[model samples]
Target: MKIKGLSTIRQKLMVFVVLLCGVLLGLVWLLNVWLLESFYTHKVHTDLQRTADAFSLLIQKYETLEDPSQPNGISPDFYSAVQQPEYTTMLLGKCIEIADANYNCLLGNHALSSGQCLLHPARTTLFGDTGLPSWNNKNVLAYRAQTLADGDMYFTLNGQNGMRQMVVCKNVADRYTVIVSTDLERIGQAGEVIGQQVPLIAAVLLAVSILGAYLFSKWFTKPITELSHAAREVAKGNYQVRVREPENADELGQLARDFNTMAAEVGRTSELQRDLIANVSHDLRTPLTLIKGYAETVRDLTGDDKQKRTDQLDVIVDETDRLSGLVNSVMELSKYSSGTMKMEPVRFDLAQLCDEVADRYRNVCEQNGYHLDVQTDQVCMVKADPDSMSRAIHNLLSNAIHHIGEDGYVALHVKPQADGSTRVEIIDHGAGISKEDLPYIFDKYYRSRADAGKVGTGLGLSITKAILISHGYAFGVDSELGKGSTFWFVAAAAEPEKSAEA
Candidate 1:
């Protein structure tokens, strides 16, 4: 299913980022809710166990100094050490109850006056016992008391009044059993306070994350947005619009650069289309006007005169042939450019082909007082479609003929390169193409101002370009404004045995 409003990349990115943030925040909340109280409970039990262990060690030490004369089976110095500031600090949030095997209280520290300690219960006197059970649940107390009695050195218990207590029942030197108890309600209260603030903190963090997500999405999708806008402008026939190319060597930057190139090519093509219309209209109208005017002359003025009528009729035929040639060139160019013109490549001597084509053009060049020179010192053989290649050669020869120098000199050469390729060149000495016009010389319908009034359609070079490109041959032209131009194409050399077999 397609979702609305998130059709663009920016919206989808924002939603994805927000969802990621929410998932992380949810995990943090879950850990706090499920594990925070347990963590606090574990810490309370650890402290109580350490206090009980410390008191047990002290009782063992007092055994060495036990004089039957000392009261409570402990020396005065041992009692003072038990009440030291550091030792008392360990019992800040806790109560310590030391008792004999008969369960008579021997020492009580930090006990509440309201009978809070499970073992001591009251502090009125050394023998104080309220006769009230310290545990609200007798079943719980009985189970824990049995566990301690079953040879367990120490045991911890939790009472219903939010208290946790640790009991070390080892009679050290047969003197004292120590009980250490701490209230766990403070840990519970701290957890509750943190729980209350979670929602507010989460809300603030979520808001910040959402805003950051929006900003990040906007930054990331800026290029795509510009490209889309440029595309729309192009669709509306504004080919000049372009997007800013980014400097980073990423896919998005490559896309922007390619888009700019495409826009430039499209703009050039659009301009060429306009040129095609103008050039075709001009070329077609000249011959058509001649044909119509001469046909009228034959019908109205030269009908009764044999010589004049024959001449007029011949002119009409020539003009009609020119029209046919123009139409044929246009159709052939379309075929070559569209890649519908198939090639039947076979190995042939390029030098021999150049000689044959130059020979064909010799009569036309002589009649026009132009010199056609052909120099082929070596037999350069290549594989290509013969008919298409012949047509390309004819076009280049015609182009050179029209643009030859005042001395009427044009040369065609066939040379074998050091690499396994053959280069064919047609050179003309007429007013050569400028550097500016050389780049567009092979573009269809592109005619430099120098050759604007030349005799043929401007598609000859373009047709040659398409033909060479189809054969995978490289072709180029080198020219200076006053030094004339050399149009050439290079084709890979083919083996004679392969040609003979083919």
Candidate 2:
């Protein structure tokens, strides 16, 4: 079953961290509870062996003593070494006995002061052996036999008083055997102490782990939460909402940067959408208003006058055509910008296309006292979508006409370059674009301050850009304020095929 609490990143992170800490602490607690006694026993055995070795070294140093009747049968130097802090601390509270090969006590601690010396049996027996009656305690006899057979042995023995003792025995220097014993009560005390303190340590560690997990979860999930809130704001059409960028070079930081970039693009598109709606509405309403008003005028007043009636009807027809053209332009721009328009490229004469487009504007140019110039000499065959390229050329020419006022001229030039490319340019002597506006001149719905009152949708140049780009043609505009503008596009020149031999 899916638990809601563990669904989020923060919750899951906290759960994982807590579980990890819990597993570590639980392992430590188990080791302390189950293995503490064995660990302590091993340590005690190691200490016993170390002490035995030190005692053996002292014995070797004093083995040549002239008189064996000295105090404790050891030299003053051996006594001094045993009384030193290193040996005294290791043997403290433990019974130590050093005996000769004949079982005669050479040196001993307080345990030997009772006149008891550890003796080795002539024939040793294993532990739990029923046939041998060697030492009074079978465990002591078994351990003694093991020490003799194995050179050193560690074991636990029960004294006659029923107290348990841990013992270690080792034969040293080929003459003396060193035996050390300690009460098993200290190990029991340590086990009890560990049992009491483990829970407390675990509780303290658990509390610290909980705090650390919470802080880490908060730090890890903070960016995701911010991104979620910003996404919600964007869903509500608030494109201005921005998330703070993280300074780290990790994935979350990169995600934050990407989110900010997407938000900025969304904001820009939203602004363009608003402008498109406003501009389209304005353009549509004007022609619509003109068509409605002119038709009503023809019906109300010019019905009887035939000449006046024709003129009013013509105004209505022109306004209707203008509205239709505007709608079609909007549709075409959308098609090109949305990448839905299919390009059908064929080898076509660029010079011929320019001539045809200029011929269509010949009457308008003459009527407005504007000169239309077409400069081309070569065939300049290029591979491009004929219909779309025609539209782009028409739009450029129309744009030039709109910008260049009465008495101004529009020039169309088709030139072939040495690199097997064709260049088509439409030049107009008009109020040129400013440096600040040149960069965004081809943006949708963009209008310069000078062209704000002009009659044309601002999508002409943008549509031209999209059309040329789809055909893989390089197109741009160069303009200087008050010096005219030149808009041009370049297309690859198609090679003419040679005639086949018969």
Candidate 3:
């Protein structure tokens, strides 16, 4: 089913803009989550490595103060390092023990009931058969690796708080090694601050994305909405609907210009159609009224002269014929306007067509005392509907003959132009049209001053113009006041062999 009113352009644009905003907001949410996770994870890992390095350095300094050959005890510097005010020692409040490689405590006792120190078990297990470090296993993360530079193992311990954590451990050395650690609560606190702000950051990003989408949509559719409103006004028959386009030659501005041009042309055509109907109605009614009156008079004559009756009958027949011709022209113009006129184009010598048209009007010109001149020096085989083209040529010729005054001459000229096209021109030495009326001479019922009192229904030139336009030929009239008028039409060069070659 077709959607009512959904086909309108504004609705489509609104939907597109809203959907675009939704998509952008969604992508912003996803990107924020990813960036937040990456930043926090990276910061946490760096803090952990730093904590482990610091503990390793402190232990190495303490080991330096102890004896190497005998069992080394806790150094004086180790006690001093523990007493440092700025340091955070997990070993301070927590009970711990110092142990040898054989799991025997060499320092003062802080052992458990299992005869193993709580810290000792953690240390032994970290380097023992499990092949994994157990730095207070449940509450910690640790790693024991043989150092690449010295081939000595180092044990590291870590704990996470919020999104960050720190690691601490002892590095294995040649003669002595010591254990140390630092609390990661500070780094973890900083990580927690960042994690807590994620939602707020994500909200800001979403808002920005939505705002950006809205602004872009507004920018892009500004001209489009103007065009839509203009189109609507045009639909209401306001052909003056015009958009103030930007002076720049952008696509949207150019589209507005084209639309404006189209609307103006439509307005012109509407006025022309109105004039055409009025003139046609007037021309048709006059001849029809004459014929009707003449026939009625013949019928009402009680004792008329036979010759007078015959003359009235003749006038009626002539007026009837004129009316029929006008009607036929109207029908032909309708066919052409409705795109129902069919032209059976064929290859024919255009020279022959012009000659035939000139000949048809020759006897009439001579009877009207107008000398007829035919000028042709070339033959053109053009692709066209011969009947239509011949009619066009005959129209100009007949018009010239009718306008030529006594002792005047009408000339029919046919020749090829430099542009590979053939032109047929009909010129008359008679009273011509006014400059003001020449522009509308091809319109139905149009009559020049030279055609005054002539029995023309005024449809021949119009029919000729329509026929020529439909054939895609060029036709026009040039007139000068008092001198004469010339009507000309051009036929394009095409297949000389046959018009049916297509």
Candidate 4:
């Protein structure tokens, strides 16, 4: 068995769709993560601002009650006002010339030693050493809060275990620092869960896609499969195998149309072949019947009277010759049909060959009391097989003589063609062949039965046509019912100059 290559179309399509879907999903997920991060940052900032507002209120009350002569440490009221379920608060000095790296926390509910305000990557430029930077680096507010005396109270926040805190400071003189934070690690864990689920979803989708691909491939190749089987049936001489049409009218439809045409041609050719065989059988049997009857009569019933015996013998001889000619003609036609005829090139004189051919039929015409008309100049030279060329001319002359009635004339003529070739025509002034029979006159065993009395096996013109064709000459017939038929052939020049040597 021949091993064809495995199909790749399904694999290619699966890979393409899978890659496209994956890229699209990846882009959407990445966009979702970025948007969520942005929301998270915003939530953190808002929580920090809320804590700062409460701390500012408590600090204002403290300032109103404080004595300027001696500053008091942070009162408990400041931390209490900013306290939240998830936040811490601290009170730093309101009036102290804060050094480059200062830490003066006055009070705290729970504060780290680091006097730093809450900061992420975005805020790291305005607080002391051990302090997270202020929110905006280019602001005079951040600069004053970090460098000037009685600067902003600094708050540092740390997220509680499983919780987050936000730290907020109100202004440069406020002694309260508040921190607030929220749990954001839970969001990361949720994303991990989604990431783990993606491949499982892809696997499920791939399984469905594979099933779909298999079904589609089978469906696509189905028509071709049916066509192949139909062709096999047609080869078995069934012309009725029309393709069962599917809903699709694509290339397969055209193939079906072509297949039907091929089957039709095959069926028609087979019928013609059968008809030809029957015709050939009938054609041969008629002459055999005549010859056999004439032979048996001369042998047994007809007395040995010289004239009667001669006439009967002549009939038998003529019919026998006709049978031989018919058989030879059929053989030649079969050779032509089988493409076994060999073509040969040779040099010979055309006019001499025509003269010889005319002489033979002249005898026949004289014996039958008909005029033999020969017309041509001498030396019509051409390049053709002398034997086949003579046979072609002889067949034409014989046909004319055979058809010419008593006192009727048979004419043989040779002339030069425009293309350095010679044309020979044989004409008979007898009952002419019919128009309908003219086209198939050269067909094997085709005879014009308009005259039922006509003899011979009906392969005369067929053999003549084959002989001329093998020599690359052209031949055809022209006739009217009463005007007789002209059978003509043109022979190519035998290097007309070279004929001088011959």
Cα RMSD of all models vs. native, in order, equals 9.1, 10.4, 11.8, 17.2
User: What tens-digit string does per-residue lDDT give for candidate 2 at 1-502?
Assistant: 5767677888888888888988998788677767877887887777777877887777787774224676435566666667787776776656766655654444555332222323323222111121223332454444444565578777786555446667778876556667787665555666678889988887888898889999999999999999999999998999989998987889999999999989988887787788778888888889889888878888898889999889888888898898888888889999998899988878889889888888999999888889998887788988888899899999899999888944488999999999989999999999899997787788888888788766777989989999988888998999988878999999877767668999
Model 3 ranges off by over 4 Å: 1-19, 35-259, 302-304, 402-409, 417-420, 429-458, 478-486, 496-502
Global CA lDDT computed for model 2: 0.77
Measured with C-alpha atoms, the lDDT of residue 287 in candidate 3 is 78
Candidate 4 local lDDT, 276-377, one digit each (tens): 676666666776787888788878877677787789888878877767766777787778556686656577778888888787766666676788889867
Over the stretch 356-399, how does candidate 3's per-residue lDDT look in tens digits? 77787777766766688888758876889888787778778878
> In candidate 4, residue 159 scores what lDDT?
49
Q: Which parts of model 1 have CA positions greater than 4 angstroms off?
A: 27-198, 495-502
Model 4 lDDT, residue 109, Cα: 29
- Local distance difference test, candidate 4: 0.61
- Using lDDT as the measure, name the better of candidate 1 and candidate 2: 1
For candidate 4, the clash count comes to 14
How many clashes show up per model? 0, 0, 1, 14
lDDT of 1 at 1: 52
Which lDDT tens digits does candidate 1 get at residues 1-502?
Answer: 5668788888888888888988988887776766777876677677777887887787776664334576555467877787787787776656665655444445656543235655444334321332334421353344334434553355655666566555544444454456666554555566677778889988998899889999999999999989999999999999989899888989999999999999999999999999888888888989999999999988899899999999988998898898998899899999999999988999888888889889988899889888888998798889899999999998998899888899899999999999879999999998899988889999999999887766678989989999999998999999988878899999887855734565
On the 0 to 100 scale, the lDDT of residue 298 in model 1 is 86
What are the models' TM-scores? Answer: 0.67, 0.58, 0.59, 0.46
